[model samples]
Every structure is written in C-alpha cells, then in structure tokens.
Target: MTRAFLGLGSNLGDRMGYLKDAVAAMDDCVAVSGIYETDPVGGPDQGRYLNVVAELDTSRSARDLLELCQMLEAAAERVRDVRWGPRTLDVDVLWVDGETVDEPDLVVPHPRMFERAFVMVPLGELAPDLAEGWSDPANGDCRRLGDWDELVPPASEGIS
Candidate 1:
C-alpha cells in the first residue's frame, strides 16, 4: 500500500459533519490529521475554514486518488461556481509515497503545500517524515490544534 496525503477543508454549512461524512465514506484506508481552524487564504471574502490533512494507505494510483477526492467533494455538495469560493468540502492530494507526478490534471506533493500553513500544520502532524525538508521561512501564524489522535476519531471508530 502506498502512503498518500490528502488536504481537506470546509467552510460552508456543518463543516465538521462534512468532514466526518467524507472520512466515513473512505472505508478503512484513511487516517486523518488534526483538524485546525484557519483564516481565509485568498480569492474572496469568506468564512474561516476547518482544515485537516489525511494519510492514506491505498493501492489507488495518484490520478485515481485525485478522482476519488473529487467524488468525495461532490458527495458533500462542493461547487466550482467561483474560484476559491466557499464550499461544503474541498479535498486535495498533497503527497503520494515520495512520487512526483506532473500532469495536466494532477500534481503530486501538491504544488502549493509549502505556502499554505493550513496544509502544513495538519500535515506535519500526520506525517512529519514527509514534511521534514519542507519549510516556510516566513510561517509564523500556524499553530497546532492538538495531537492527531485527539483530533480524529479512533481507528476503531472506523471512519464515522
């Protein structure tokens, strides 16, 4: 099984519920990072987002994972009406077992990971090994919410 990292965020209604539901739908291949509430990053005026990073052990290819993430977003009623607009859910593939994939539709290790604290903080919690060499010299605002175990449900909870 390849290790994959996913970035999830929600700013619309029932943000935490959307996250819980998405994880529940992923079966047993996923483990989530601590959830952090963050300020809006860009695009437009919007609500703060509850963000988390997830680690997955799966046989799915990078492209397939991207598709699956989109499906999860759709299940949460995510819409693309405006760039960086509010959404029920947003899932992004952050890394895939040290593989670097560059394609028209997907990029591994996510092109913007280092620049976003919301992504880095939770990611650092779930897989610090993967985040070892990555750093943002200017990062000063990101704070750890808590331990990953304290943030996500226990593995025995089985997603829901």
Candidate 2:
C-alpha cells in the first residue's frame, strides 16, 4: 500500500463535521495531525478554515485518490462556484508515497503545498522529515487549534 498524504480543509457549514466524516470514510488512516485554523488565502472573501493533514496507507492509485477526494468533497456538498471559493470541504492529494505526478487533472506534491501555511503546519506535525527545509509561503496566518482527536469527534459520534 502507498502512504499518501492528504490535505483537508473546511470553512462552510459544520467545518469540523466535514473533516471527521472525510477521515472516517478513508480506507486506512494511519495518522492525523492536529487541527489548524487559518484565513483564506485567495479567491473571494470567505470564512476561516479548519485544516488538518492525514496520512493514509492505501491500495489506491493517484487517480483513484483524486476521485476519493472529490467524492468526499461532494459528500460535504462542496461547490465550485468560484476559484478557491468557500466550501463545505476541500480535500487535496498532497503526495502519494513521495512519488511525483504530473497530470492534467492532478499534480503530486501539490503544486503549491509549500506556499500555504495551512498545509505546511499540520503536515509538518505528522511528517516532520517531509516538512523540513520548506519555507512557509506566508499567504495567511496559521495557528494550531488542537489535536485531531481532541478537536474532531470520533466517527461513532459523527455521521454513520
């Protein structure tokens, strides 16, 4: 199985709820970083986002992972009305087994993972070795809210 790093964020209805649901829907979640709250970086003005990074051991391809991300986002009622617009959920396939991917619909190592504090901070928590030496883009302020277990509810308490 490939160890894929996924970046998750929510700013719309039940922000934490969306995140918890996404996690529970995953195949095998090995670890989850603490939650970080940050301001939106681009697109139209929007609410602050609750963000976290999850490491998954999965038997899925990059394309499959991308599809899963979209599925989870759709489950959260995500809309693409505007670029980087507000949404109930945002799931990004940051990296897959440290492999680089270049495709029309997806990009590995996330084209801008290093540029966003929201992604870097939580990611650093779960994989410090991977996060090292990367400069923060300073696009927006990112601060830790709490651990995933402490911030988000267990699946039993969330959606079925």
Candidate 3:
C-alpha cells in the first residue's frame, strides 16, 4: 500500500461533522489527524476553518485517489463558484509517498502545502519524520492550535 497525505477543511456549517463524516465515508483508505481551527489565509472574507490532515493507506493510484477526494468533496456539497471560497468541505492531496505529479487538475505535494499553516500543523503531528524536512524558515508562520491534543481521536477509533 502507498501512503498518501490528504488535507481537509470546512468553514461552513457544522465543521466538525463535515470533517468526521467525510472521513467516515472513506472507511477503508483514510485515517485522520487531530483537527485544528485556523485563521483564513487567502481569498475573500470567510470564517475560520476547522482543518485536519489524513494519512491514507491505499493501493489506489494517484489519479484514483484524486478521484476519491473529489467525490468526497462533491458529496459534501462543495461548489466551485468561488476560488478559496467557503465550502462544506475541501479535500486536497498533499503528498503521495515519493511520487511527484503535476497536472492541470491536481498537483501532488499540493503545490502550496509547504506554505500553509493549517496543512502543516496536523500533518506534523501525524508524521513527524516527514515533517522534519518541511520545517524551515519558509514554514515559520505555522502555529499549533492549543487544543490539538484534545481533538485527536483515540487510536482505536481511527488510524493516526
């Protein structure tokens, strides 16, 4: 199985539920990190986001995982009318093991993953070894939410 990283966020509606349900829907392939509440980084005015990073153990190829991410987003009623707009849920493929894929529809390593605090914090918690190379001057702004430990689910509840 290939280990892949996914970033998830929801700023609209019951954010926690949107996140939990999205993970629950992908029963076989995904495991969530501790959730964090983060300030908005870009785009127009919007609410703060509840974010999490997930590690997926799957035999699915990169393209297949991309499709699954999109399906989960759509299932949560995400719309593309606005870029960086608020949504029910946002699922991004952050990394795919050692592979690097750059395409019009998707970019593995998530193009901007290194720069986003929301993506980095929970990711760091789940994979400290992988997080090592990622922590640099460029990622200085990333901050850990104080209640992070409290939000992490028990290991028996999900893979982490």
Q: Candidate 2 clash total? A: 0
Task: Write one digit per residue (lDDT tens) for candidate 3, span 48-123.
Answer: 8888888888777778878988999998988888898888999988888878888899888788877877887788
Residue 113 Cα positional deviation in candidate 1, in Å, after optimal superposition: 0.6
Q: What lDDT tens digits, residue by residue, belong to model 1 across residues 1-40?
A: 8888888899999998888788777764567877788877
Residue 42, candidate 1: alpha-carbon lDDT: 78
Rank list by lDDT: 2, 1, 3
lDDT by residue for model 2 over 48-124, one digit each (tens)? Answer: 99999999999988888999999999899898999989999999999887578898889997999989999988998
**Judged by lDDT relative to the true structure, which candidate is superior, 2 or 3?**
2
Whole-model lDDT per candidate: 0.82, 0.89, 0.78
Q: Give candidates' CA RMSD values in order.
A: 3.1, 2.2, 4.3
What TM-score does candidate 2 get on C-alpha atoms? 0.93
Superposed model 3: Cα runs more than 4 Å off: 136-160
71: Cα error in model 3, Å: 0.6
TM agreement with the true structure for every prediction: 0.86, 0.93, 0.84
